[model samples]
Target: MAEEFRLRSVAAVAYGPATLFGLAEGAILPVIALSAIDRGATTAIAALVGALIGIGSLVTNIPAGVLATRVGERRSMLLAAAVTVAGLVICLVQAGSGPWALVLYGAGVLLIGMASSVYSLARQTYLTEMVPPHMRARALSTLGGTMRVGLFAGPFAGAGAMHLWGLPGAYCVGLVAIAAAAVLVYRAPELELTAEHRAAAASITTRDMIKRRWRTYVTLGSGVLLLSAIRQARQTVIPLWAAHLGLSPTTSSIIYGVAGAIDALTFYPAGKVMDRYGRRWVAVPSTIVLGASFVLMPLTGGAVSLALAGMVMGFGNGIGSGIVMTLGADVSPAIGRPTHIGIWNELADIGTGIGPVILSAVTALAGLGPGIIVSGVVGFGAAATLWTYIPRSGALRQARAECHD
Candidate 1:
């Protein structure tokens, strides 16, 4: 079963589109706030703009999943890419148009966020339905790794574009990348659902499905939410901390890029460990390490030390690649996979959206160091929750046992 589910041509086709989408997303993410800043928004407002992506994702998550079920994964992805392109065009047209530019750019970012939610849901549903259970972790982990590779490469690409054509040019790169992804997805082989799978999916309403799985979704899903919050906080806090430390933008970018490289390198091994050992093996350590990195951030007095902390955090993040997705897949009912994933991702996006807001508010009330320390505490709390709840084996075992009974 594992051999049959390995990275075959079909998987590669899905991955190709994902890779391009990731690259596009990665190129824009690190710079959205900076772009807003350049357009004359205050730091707080700029951060809000960055957070809008998550907000948009939150709003669209369930709808995106429903759309995927109705239209099929391929068509949903294509529609998402098209919407993303429209957003990019708006950003490009309004570049450097002063305050109005901020509004337009924010709108563009929101649209892209909507598109991303759809794209991600489509791909995740595809993998969950197509890949066998035994190989699911590795396949999803590889998907995570591919996205990291794009993210690792994106900042550098944005930097170049910024140097040459300023911030809006980075959006141009994203536009082009997503366009290519759409083309690839269009050309990929169609995913056909088995008759039984279709019947199962058709029998359940999204609301009914959520009601049935509320226990696992709320209990285990809370852990996923906190983990996502910590991850978002890391992304938010790092650059702000670097600025506080008086590091050059160039230096900060390099440090983040290096950390991303470490993250990308570890995805496959982490997947292997999850598949061979258990999800807990990777989950516990990753959460703890990430928390430790946040706790240690204030201790770093210089760029070198900060980089080290980033590297440690990145390593932690790397080891848990696709973990949230894997767990969602594990517990999701086959009949309502898309709807379950939608709810799972919505909870996670809420965390992502709120993390930066919390950081910003905390930093304003106390200080940057203290704000980050608070985030660290949250991470520790999440780790504790996972340790208590995430099963020794994958959640699939429990899910299967319940189905059998």
Candidate 2:
């Protein structure tokens, strides 16, 4: 039965698209704030532009999940890729121009965010259905790792593109990668739902599912929100830190790219540990590591120190590749799973959106160092919450209750 699952086929067909899409996103994401800054946006405004991606995701998540359920994952992905291409085109066209250039670029980013939410929902839902429970973490972690591979490669690629054609050229790289992903999805083999899935789909509306599962959603979702916030804060803070330290654009990208590579290394091990020991094994350490990195970032005096801090944070992040997605999948009901996942994603996106704004505001008010320290404090708080609330197992939960008694 395990052999029949053919994980390889799924990886080849489904995750292939993810690899390309990740590469595209990775190429552009590191540059979004930089591009906005080049166009005369203040640090706060540029961070806001970067946050638009998360804002877009927050808005479209539920809709994207519903769309995936109605149209199927492959079709949804194809549609998302098309929209992403269009967004890229708009950004490219509006690059470095009139007074409205930043506005137009932000609009384009918003569109891309919408497209990404759809694509991510489709992929997550499809993988949940395809892989068996015992190996689910590993499968999803590999999926996350594959994307990281693209992310690891992308900055170097973006650097090359930036050198050859400048900022607009980075968008072009994403456009091409997403276009290729679309083509790959079109050619990939089909994934058919079982009778069980179809029946579950018919019985519950997305809204109904959420209403029934609100408690679980809120509990787990809070953790997800914090996890995502710290992750996004890392992304936003690192670049801003480099800029604050007066690092060159090329040097900043290299630091981020190298950090991504570090992040890519631990996905498989994280999965293994989670499967064998439980979620806390990976979750606690990841959060703590990230928190430590953020707290220590401001103390660093040079680019090398900053790079080391970034890599330490990357290591934490790498081990948590598919953790939020994995936890969401573990808790979601079979009925209306996509909708639940969408809601889960929405909470995460909210954190992603809020992180940058918080960092920016704090940076403006206090200092960049203080802003990062706040993120670190939040990370430690998240870790404590996860440790307290997330059960090790049914038996463990019982044991804890007995201990309290």
Task: Give per-residue CA lDDT, model 1, range 1-405, as digits (tens).
Answer: 546446764555567777788888888987888878877789999989987887789899998878877777788888999999998887676456478889988998899989999999889888776776667788788888888788777767776887898877688789878888888888876678666766666567778878898888778888888899999888766778899999999898788877878888999888778888878888879989999999999999999999999999999999999998888888777666787788889988877767777777888999999999988887887788888878676655845753673
Estimate, for each residue in 292-340, the C-alpha lDDT of model 2 and write its tens digit. Answer: 9999999987789999999999998999989888887777666577788
Clashing pairs in 2: none
Models 1 onward score TM values of 0.90, 0.87
Local lDDT at 231 for model 1 = 91
For residue 314, give model 1's deviation from the true position in Å: 0.7
Q: In candidate 1, which residue ranges exceed 4 Å CA deviation?
A: 1-5, 34-44, 95-102, 162-164, 194-196, 199-203, 395-405
Model 2 TM-score, 2 decimals = 0.87
In candidate 2, residue 248 scores what lDDT?
94
**How accurate locally, in lDDT, is each candidate?**
0.82, 0.82
Cα lDDT for residue 87, candidate 1: 82
Model 2 residue runs over 4 Å out of place are 1-5, 30-48, 94-96, 99-105, 194-196, 199-203, 242-252, 391-405
